[model samples]
Target: MEFFTIKPCKTQAAYVVEPKKPLHLDLKALKVPFDITARTPVLMAMRIDGVDVSLYPSGKMLIQCDEPECIAKKVWGEVA
Candidate 1:
């Protein structure tokens, strides 16, 4: 299934992903596996494939990196 759509943010060198549904992520469960160091009910932050990822329970994600838009798709593939 297609889990997310990637779009360039108004800010230069950044991208956003809007998911089809709210993401069901348990930070407690993901901590060890994902190496999540800090999180709250609404926000989770981590690194994936050397890229910084900020995920929201609302299913929106903000990815900041030097890679192109294709990198967002790659991250979605891994997360979804």
Candidate 2:
């Protein structure tokens, strides 16, 4: 899919890609637990649908899971 890339993982699949535009996420507002803003504003630590996720300021993201493509589409679709 346009929003992510699928790759094989030990336990499942993973996705790595960037969005068409940068995401404007408010860590404080969202209460994000991880930090990547000092250098690249990368929130490379999060979870959704039990899958580990990472989002970067450059609009890049890494989604790991079994069937990452399907999960990414579902997640992005709802978020977008």
Candidate 3:
């Protein structure tokens, strides 16, 4: 099943991805190539391919990238 939905952001060059159902993610255990810039109990921020990405415990992500769908798939794939 599709893990998440992708929608264009109101501003240019951004996208928001959210899980289909309520989801809680542990940012500390999530493995990605990007560096985690700022992290807290509820939020984690990182940079991927020169774009900003913010991940929340609710399994929502704000991606400032030209190809958000690709990034989303990569992320969800890892988590799943």
**What RMSD value applies to candidate 3?**
2.2
- What is the per-residue lDDT of model 2 for residues 4-78, given as tens digits with 9 covering 90 to 100? 334554354565655566566543344443333333233545666676776554445577754666655654563
Clashing pairs in 1: none
User: Considering lDDT, which of the candidate structures 1 and 3 is the better prediction for this target?
Assistant: 3
Q: Per-model C-alpha lDDT, please?
A: 0.63, 0.53, 0.77
TM-score per candidate, chains pooled = 0.63, 0.48, 0.76
The sequence of per-residue lDDT tens digits that candidate 3 reaches over residues 38-80 is 9887888987667788888877889997778777776667665
lDDT of 2 at 47: 68
- In candidate 1 the C-alpha lDDT for residue 10 amounts to 89
Cα lDDT tens digits for candidate 1, 1-80: 25456777888667787777766765444432344546877777867667777777655778787653554465456555
Ranking by TM-score: 3, 1, 2
TM-score of model number 3: 0.76
Alpha-carbon runs more than 4 Å astray in model 3:
1-3, 28-31
